[model samples]
Target: MSHVTPALYATLAEIVPELHVHCVEPWCVIGSAAALLAGADVSVADVDLLVSRADADTLMTLWAERRESVYEPAGAERFRSHFARFRFPGLPVEVMGGLELDQGDGWKPVKARRLTLAGLNGLAVPVPSLDDQIRILESFGREKDVQRAKALRALASSPLRGED
Candidate 1:
């Protein structure tokens, strides 16, 4: 896997502990952030957290002051979640509760098929594995997501990078 940046690690350090404390259900980082943690070549604008609805509510209530009251996430038709955005010192973090994708047949929950822990300052921060991340991106089917999935596929097959 590629190395995680200090800035990103720092940001995670600030937020992840509280998540572990407050969120009772399973949770993990997703989107470009997860890809980045999995060693895929991608840029992360902000942290995308996948959580249960109850956890989302808990976090929303806890971080009420930092919540973006008027912000609405893009891709309303493509995705659904009990979503909220928060401002943090290192970067913005978005919480997606029970996120589901519109798969034409029906809505399918986006879940971590395999959870990988990316260590940060002794904290085992949960992120989806590279393969799982690829599957998710492909499921999204957006041009950018497809491209990221391709990149992840390449990284997974790279002789230079060993399997985790």
Candidate 2:
């Protein structure tokens, strides 16, 4: 488990202000990033963002100037079904409006919504609740997702250091 470093957060603050960023990546500032932000030892390879269809279009147009390559699909047809992938500097970014998680019997749609703020190093980064994250991961049912859900569950049950 690796945590997000101050430098990474700083970079995020510069590239995507908290106001414009909505973290939907489990391994990003919301999942691994939140864990790291909470003092857990965790690290991930890239960033995932959940933005509105409009925002996604805006990002596609705006980031084109800084993108290293053309947008590509993330992975399996199901996974890549709704996502647009690209790279920025040292970060891999995925923008999507919705996601479908495999539930063994069928796929469950995870709809996008207005993101709430999660405090990290004084920055209010948009993120989903721990329960929401766990639900999404559990639905995926992959070994790694199960492991991540467990970690997130543990984090959720623990007390926030400064919260009463």
Highest TM-score among the candidates is held by which one? 1
Each model's TM-score? 0.93, 0.70
Q: Once model 2 is optimally superposed onto the true structure by TM-score, how far is the C-alpha of residue 93 displaced, in angstroms?
A: 1.7
Worst 10 residues of 2 by lDDT: 22-31
Q: In candidate 1, residue 47 scores what lDDT? A: 92
Q: Write one digit per residue (lDDT tens) for candidate 1, span 1-164.
A: 33766667767888999998999998999888788877787877889999999999999999999998898998899999999999987788999999999988888899988898987668878998888888899999888889889989999999998776
**lDDT of model 1, residue 117:** 91
Off by more than 4 A, model 1 = 1-3
Residues 1-164 of candidate 2 have per-residue lDDT tens digits of 12565556655665566325533342223445544444444565556665555566666676766554655654353453345666555556666644555445466556423244566556666566666666666665667667777887777777764331
Model 2 stretches with alpha carbons more than 4 Å out: 18-31, 34-40, 68-75, 102-108, 112-115, 159-164
Clashes of each: 0, 6
Model 2 CA RMSD to the hidden true structure, in angstroms: 4.7
Name the top lDDT candidate.
1
